[model samples]
Target: MAMGKVPGDSEGGDEVGFAEINITPLTDIFLVLLIIFMVTSSVIVQQAPSGGAQTGLKVNLPKGGATDVTARATDMSVAILSDGRFVLGGNIVTEDELKRAFNDAQQKDPDTIVIVQADEGVPHGTVVQVMELAKGAGLGQLAIGVREPQ
Candidate 1:
């Protein structure tokens, strides 16, 4: 019996040795792959788009239609139904009440944005009227909401 090699009777004039598993090469490959994945993930994270304002001119209309305009959400959402009923955050509200709500929201933050989500069947004039109210409240960051195309 040898210290490293398995004991084999010296018969039939044949020479054979036991094979041992090595871990050093496998560990080295694993470390290299891990570093590559970490660096690639960081680069992907940095390249993603940031949360920022998007601006674009509405397309295919004479600036009066709302079909192509995009409407984004704000921290404050106001809804106007087809029946001229107004609601703020799902609660029924009168025009004066809505104005007061806007006043309160404005007092909290000057840069507060307002979103108007109205029914498509509602008259454009009605939506404009709501916009006028928002303007009077000194809320310039206005966004009109629309349903996405199916």
Candidate 2:
């Protein structure tokens, strides 16, 4: 709000009303909306499910003495169940399909690392076979997934 006189009016005359736009309220609304968006975005990210073996078949990973390693975007995850089932990319896959997947990954990126997650009850030979399959498909980097010792 403001007060001003007409151009020809005397300075000592009565003051006339002049409207002035106020933006404080508009600024406050935008700041509140920004905060709401930030809060909701963080909540959504925290609630989202992770993509990989964690979402695949349940496997009781054996405890290992190796240091912890985090998953990478380009890394491939393969899971072997206790009953000798093969799971790739969150789906049960045949040995042939698994080989195709490895080949595709290797063709896409030869340096792609394969992370094998075998159940504690899985046979040692099965793990070796899967590793050899990856090697045959031209994938060299391999890693074994294990849980940290309690």
Query: Candidates' lDDT values, in order?
Result: 0.75, 0.87
Estimate, for each residue in 25-140, the C-alpha lDDT of model 1 and write its tens digit. 99999999999999877654542234544323323535666455343343578899989899897799999998888888778776777888998789999888888887898887
**lDDT by residue for model 2 (1-150), tens:** 587875687657877786667889999999999999998776545421455333333446799655566678878999999999999989999999999999999999998999999999999999999999999999999999887669
Model 2: residues with Cα > 4 Å off, grouped in runs: 1-67
Best by TM-score: 2
Evaluate model 2: give its TM-score.
Answer: 0.55
Judged by lDDT against the true structure, how good is candidate 2? 0.87
Of candidate 1, the 10-residue stretch with the lowest lDDT total is 47-56
Counting clashing residue pairs in each candidate, in order, gives 0, 0
In model 1, the runs with Cα more than 4 Å from the true position are 1-74
Candidate 1 local Cα displacement, residue 77, angstroms: 0.8
Predicted structure 1: lDDT: 0.75
**TM-score against truth, every candidate:** 0.51, 0.55
